[model samples]
Target: MAVRRALALSAVDRYAAMMISLAVFAATGRILGPAEVGMAVLGLTAYALIEVIRDVPTAYLVQQPETSAPAVRSAFTVMASISVLAALMLFLAAPGLAHVIGNDDMYPFFRIIAVALLLGPFERPLVALMRRDLAFDKVALVNIASGGCNAIVVVGLALAGFEEVSFAWALLAGNLAAVAVAWALSPYRRLLGIAISEWRKVLLIGGSSGLWGLIWRYTDSLPQIAFGALSQPAAAGTYSRAQTIVELPGKLLFVVVSQVALPALAAQRRDGRELKGAVLDSLAVISALQWPAFLLVACLAHPLILLLLGPRWLDVVPLVQVLAIARLFAPLELMVYPLLLAARQTGRLLLSAAIPACVYTPVIFVLASYGGFATACAYLVLIPVNTLVGYLMIRRELGVRATEVLGALSPSVLVTAGSAIGPLAILAAHGFRFDLPIGTACAVTVTAAIGWAAAIVASGHRLSPELRHIALLAWRWASPRLRVGS
Candidate 1:
């Protein structure tokens, strides 16, 4: 029941969070324009770069069955210490960074962002506390409230004539709201509890975990920095929006699922069979959603761009399509990431993350610098390649064979592949132009969906036992109500 509740709440939270954020971006992006939004992206990029510090403690607490007060306090202290140090480093270096980027506007923007970090570290343990106990209800409330805070602050400030710094100020306001709400919900107290042994444990555990988190963020953030420096801020804004559009759905789902997944997987860590089963099952579920949704978005990027971002932002359409296609391979990483962390294989996690940083970074940087966002998006082949490497490592370390892994994913892969044929044919028939009229786009999409649903039924994959049971349960409950109403 806890697992069921967590899943339900996570779905709700993702929907709520994604909608609110989209609304926020639509309002703010239209008003502020891309250059100012680009500046905001740069400032926020600092947050990701510093996330290595907070990840250690959060991962530590989540993997524990129960955290002692002293352990919690110790984790909080270390996180706070590093967060402050990172903030100070950014604060002092902001001016120099702006100078290097040749943008006087970025100096104060980065400084304001630095101030938000001081208040954010205190919220980590509070978050870990709620998550460890599977209290997703509280988690959802806090997320909704904090996201509301960010939207209100950004929109209100932008309407009041603030431009570049509106997003920076929102960060400060949002972080403050999150910290305050977390404190209200948490039973943990602020303490200066310093224990050498505890610090040693955090270092030992966090050594690889922290590095793994940092590498992932660095990979995600470096392109923004490059665009900010090499391309126009407007271009950076376009790329940033593209990145956000492709990532938004996955991020929303992953945030909730990964939180629940870590603790759940950790609980099963002692049983190798159960842990392996958990990982494969998760991959299947994620593949069932991720493949079709991302691929459909790729196919339908035109109408999606028109409806969501409007005419002036149509430049993002191609980037969005490419990115959505590239993201098709993300389910493997998403499933494996939390499982590896739960299994205490942070060493392998670090190596997998490092592979991309070392091999793909230079390639992506060149692409972003010379070829632009579309070219960079095309390089997402690295994701699948890196996942392949991780897969072999998992087989070696966890003794999970390739056959077992492929069995879990192949149904969705083949089914989704079969489903894509109609869209591809329709797209080809239309000469592959994405900027179709709304009426035509609607017709194409509806026809494609209908055809896919029909194919799924015809193939009998739609009647898989799990889905069949769900259908039976739904009908059993609803048929009685229908009879009574008749």
Candidate 2:
């Protein structure tokens, strides 16, 4: 499949999943208090750390030059063993973990979430196989089905007053749905068997990735865990929600791009194509979209919280604004990981992850004791430092200079400035207050969108031509319909 088509499918899938998740989150936020939400976050964070191991097998399979039946089966065997063992360990540890978090009531939440870990062995490797063939349409189908089921289950249970454990049950249901859909659609549906002959190869490639995954997961999870342990009852949940909101753009853009990037870049390398141009183009496109989106989120933080999580989440507004700004340099960090993975530079990838983990984890933990607000402020410093380390690594590995990277990103700066004008104007007019009337908020959004479009054309960012093509296609489609109606 063409890369663009793959990206489009991934984007559609991610956007749909995001909407479903947001709906569930908003519903639950309204139905459950911050303490309940915090407990759920703690449980999910623990699950996510364990889930990092599951990605190792998937990464190994996806990056292979070619796959045989034995290799696929071996990957599956590894994943299944890891999943079952991890699930059992987590189940046994739940009580102790809950006690450590100062909430013995969280034992059930952790145990329920552990049950979802078992589904990983069944679902992830199949998805990886599909992604290997660039069969993103099939991947999209699986994701949409899973997400729909998850939304239904979560909303239903939350409305029934199951509280935070509703999320745990919904997670298990979603993974089961994904497993069923993937099993039905996977080309490797009949490739089921166990073999360890290639286990060494899988482990060699995946070991570093797994380690990096562990560090990366902990880096993200530690702050929240710390909040759960050290801060007020609501701090963890509030921070988690703020992160959810701030990460929407990254999840939408970076996740879609990265899903397509690693396999695509690996293919390019196998074909003896130079990766420099592709890397630069990706940076340009990512910055152009990501920067403007984060800026808009910062500008509209209060109204967004009002609209999405209700007034009950008002404390999250400033955290969202701060984190959104901190995330401006995120494109740099996002570009590095897949590039390293594609280049088979797992060592460098491990180092890149380690640098940030070593630097920021302890500091964030300390700040967590103070409050979520302090923790958010720490990211303002942490992200830039992380980005610099990543940029240096990219430079060292790819031999791409600062000038080249800056040149690619320059147009995006203009585009961001242009996109920010309307929102900033509105904010300035309102003395930078985020609490605006619905109609005014709508006006700000529309004008900011208009400004973004104008800037895209004016600055000639890489995405401009694609935007024009989409516009032309839309016009062509609408013209005949309008004439027929008239």
Candidate 3:
């Protein structure tokens, strides 16, 4: 029942948030120029950095199941303090940072977003705590409401001629809304007199996680910075759009799993076997759902881009395709990332995160300078290689064999391939372009449905009893409803 609630609520929140964000981007992109959009991206990048910087304390506070309310509050206090300091420093230094990235216009936008940074600490630990407690329903409600509010505010500001500033303002409004809702729902209130020393236990944990998070941020952020420098703002915006679309499904999956998985794993931390089993099950479920999404996006990149963003975004199709190729491996990254945290493999986690950070940035910069966005994305082809290395390390620590990992993921691969073939054949038979978006969507949908059905059939007619039971229950529930309607 809890899982059902979480799944249902999360699906609603994810769908709503995705639609709202896409709407905001579409509306704003029409109003703002490339440079303004670039600054908007820069503002978002800055905000992400600030949050990464705060990740240490916030992560530690949220991850520790044994932590007392007072201790958790104090950790939040420390993070809040650091966030304020960072925001202030960044606000003062926005001009220099903007200039460093070769965009003077970003300074004002960056400064505006810096105020939103202060709200990050208040919001982060709360959501983290809620996730730790497995209160996903509340989390979903809060996220949907927050996203809805941000979307409305952004559209309003765009109409009011704020242009690029609308994004920054929308972020601030969203964070404010989330913080308010989280606080109202939280058992404890923010205290003005919370002391720093009370947070010593989780402080070190946060600091370590924060350091690793900063490295991960650098890994992801370098592409944007390099693209901005090597290519034009329009090019960077295009790349950003590709990333936004490619990442949407992965982010939705991450949001749902992250909220549920950490606490679930942490609760089973002592039972390594059970924990490993749970993780495998999670990978199976995620891979089954997520693989089709990336495949669809990759197959339909050109049409999807044109349909969603108009002709101006056509340039992003190739880059989006490249990204789609790499994103097929994203679920494993999501699965292993939390497992490492739960296993107290902090040093290994840092090493795993740092390696990608260290390798990806310079490669992108050099490639972008020599070639273009597509070449830079070519670097990401190595992600599967890196993911293999990560899982090997995780397996060693968890005492699970590589075969176990392979076995768990094998079903998903078969199902995903089965589902993808129909779409590929149909698209190949009738070229990539279609007369109508609706027609393309329908074709893709039918293809995927056929593929999934084939996959279930091919899984040897002895499907997992749990899944079989679920199908039976679903049919039993639906048949009566169908009859009633008839």
Tens digit of lDDT per residue, candidate 2, span 81-185?
888898898899998988877788778888888888888877788898888888889999999999999889988898898888888999989999999999999
Cα error, residue 246 of model 2, in Å, equals: 1.1
Task: Tell me the spans in candidate 2 whose CA falls farther than 4 Å from its real position.
Answer: 1-8, 63-69, 133-135, 185-194, 231-233, 259-274, 484-486
Task: Say which prediction, candidate 1 or candidate 3, comes out ahead on TM-score.
Answer: 1
Estimate candidate 3's alpha-carbon lDDT, on a 0 to 1 scale: 0.74
lDDT, candidate 2, at 317: 91
* TM-score-based ranking: 2, 1, 3
Q: In candidate 1, how many Å is residue 359 off?
A: 1.0
lDDT of 3 by residue, 297-358 (tens): 87777777666667766767777778877877665688777888888888888888877766
The digit string of per-residue lDDT tens for model 1 on 69-118 reads 66776787788888788889999999887775557767887788888888
Identify the candidate with maximal lDDT.
2
Better of 1 and 2 by lDDT: 2
Cα deviation at 15, candidate 3, in Å, is: 5.6
Candidate 3: deviation at residue 224, Å? 0.9
